[model samples]
Target: GAGVSQSPSNKVTEKGKDVELRCDPISGHTALYWYRQSLGQGLEFLIYFQGNSAPDKSGLPSDRFSAERTGGSVSTLTIQRTQQEDSAVYLCASSNGQLTNEKLFFGSGTQLSVL
Candidate 1:
């Protein structure tokens, strides 16, 4: 992909339903990250994956939020039993690699709304 692509640009769901958001990252990139941004809030790092490195799950708000990256490229974020508090823009980003100084390219994001 030329840039990151996130699915379901806008999603409206019931308060207890489950939702899956997808992300397709740029070609050949080895680092992928998932983030959430609420109204008037900053980006919250949800998870991070680097080649052959342990995934950093330090930012998941709870067990109901989970994500996975396969073959070091595509990723998915699933929210089980979603809550109204979960409504927000879920963004995905990828960098050239895990080098700390690398710049990140972000996807427009899936705007999930739980009523």
Candidate 2:
């Protein structure tokens, strides 16, 4: 894909179910990130992966939320035991690096709805 690609544009699950969202970054990009935006709210950083360095998971709201990047290319975010409060649009973005002036290419995002 020429830009970031996220799978399952929308998902609806029960409160206790699990959901997984996938993202494929642009080719040769080394920085991947996950962010969530609730209705009418700003985006919240979830996790960040840069090259081989350890993933920064500090922004995850709880243990129920987790993410992993494989081969520095594709990444997946998993939300376990979903709650209504977890419903949001999960966005993925990629950049060449963390340079202050670099711009990120974002995916359309997966909108998750927990009932």
RMSD to native for every prediction? 1.4, 1.3
lDDT against the true structure, each candidate: 0.88, 0.90
Best by TM-score: 2
Candidate 1 structure quality by residue, lDDT tens digits, 1-115: 6899999899999988999999998888788888999989999989888853436999999999888888877888999999999999999988896665358999999999999
| TM-score list, all predictions | 0.93, 0.94
Question: How does model 1 score by TM-score?
Answer: 0.93
Per-residue lDDT tens digits of candidate 2, residues 9-89?
Answer: 999999999999999999998888899999999999988889635458899999999888889898889999999999999
Query: Which stretches of candidate 1 lie above 4 Å from their native place?
Result: 52-54, 100-102
| lDDT score for candidate 2 against the true structure | 0.90
Q: Best candidate per lDDT, number?
A: 2
